[model samples]
Target: MVTSNDLLIKQRSVIKFLAAEGCSAANIHAKMKTVYGEMCISDCAVRKWVRIFKGEDPREIILRDRKRSGSPLSALVTAHQEKVDCMIRANRRVKQKEIANAVGISKERVHHIITTVLGYLKVSARWVPRQLTVEMKAQRKDMCTQLLELSTVCPRMY
Candidate 1:
């Protein structure tokens, strides 16, 4: 299938060629579609480009073609959010691999939907352990004792 990028590039080239020949936008789109196949270009897209290129104070050519949104859902995602929810609710401790197997999707995809789509999961942050030397531990203990003593108040008699 022709991608939007490819279509845009081809459209620009066709517009430049048609403009040189004094062809109107509608005519240019029809001409290109007829010759280059409808998959490559559309009449409305061509018309929009012509309006921008020829109109006074030419606006940026905004192609109003519907852009594809989001990656195509795999079989796993196709199983429906409800199904995933049901599975998760039934077996909260189900491993990702087992879920993927049950849903016919990759473990990575299973994890992605669990964390991203469901929005009920957290990724653990990488942890770095601190190593305290014996001297440092002793100093910390002494500081705590001194701070506690300093904060203590004595009872007073009338």
Candidate 2:
């Protein structure tokens, strides 16, 4: 599959070739739109690349995107997930904010890990697994049976 980066490089190559042939940015952009259709780069981007190719030395032209500076968008590594799971197991009533602080991730990430990754749901202010074990299911059945027996033995006072 052609990834976005590959598509970008392809567009840059075309832009460089056309620029070298002295084609105007407007003409290059029009041709690119016809070939790439909806996936074509913006006209402004085409113009910018054309300018760079025309002004810079051929050897100095960069076809790849530059490195960006900022904190990563996600902290969903296995280590962080394991830490959050351990924290939740240790304290069923743990809050997302507390987990975020302890795990050094955002509260939203902690919530996503708990609900989506770990398959947990909040019940009575505690995090519980979404699926119950066979033993747990049997225990719940027994409890319900006992409650029914008691209800039959002692009818409602009203």
Candidate 3:
């Protein structure tokens, strides 16, 4: 249902006319239909290909892409990945939330960069309670073990 010739001749003709007459792309499209028997040219089509021609920086028509606004934060996000890795290397006790706060990004992003980019396996840390009663601490730890066991049993229960 598709073929390359749909684009090939139209592109060449647009470029050729743009180079020859110093005409606005709009005028060229009109002239093509009126003077050259090309009946299908539309204003929007001319606008689209004019961009391609401009992007090529033709020796004749020098067009530039419209300036894009508000670039993605990924471009400016400093790869504190090395810093996070250093922190992980120096002290396995630091929390990912703290690392994210220090790096000015989301905690999930910090976790992702550390685990995915740095190739560091997720680390397990011991949790200690200072003010909890013995019974409360035992209850909390029991709940955690139960959750982990349930995950293993069904792999999706928790």
- The candidate scoring highest on lDDT is 2
Off by over 4 Å in 1: 1-71, 75-78, 122-158
Sorted by lDDT (best first), the order is 2, 1, 3
Model 2 scores worst on lDDT over the 10 consecutive residues at 56-65
Evaluate model 2: give its TM-score: 0.65
- Which is better, 2 or 3, measured by lDDT? 2
lDDT of each: 0.67, 0.90, 0.64
lDDT of 1 at 150: 66
lDDT of 2 by residue, 61-109 (tens): 7998788997765555889889998999999999999999988899998
Quote the positional error of residue 83 for candidate 3 in Å: 1.3
Better of 1 and 2 by TM-score: 2
* Best-fitting candidate, scored by TM-score: 2
Residue 19, model 3, lDDT: 42
TM-score of each: 0.36, 0.65, 0.38
> Per-residue alpha-carbon lDDT of model 1 for 39-132, expressed as tens digits?
6566776776676666633576543446789877663454565566567768666677777788777787776777767654532531111346
Better of 2 and 3 by TM-score: 2
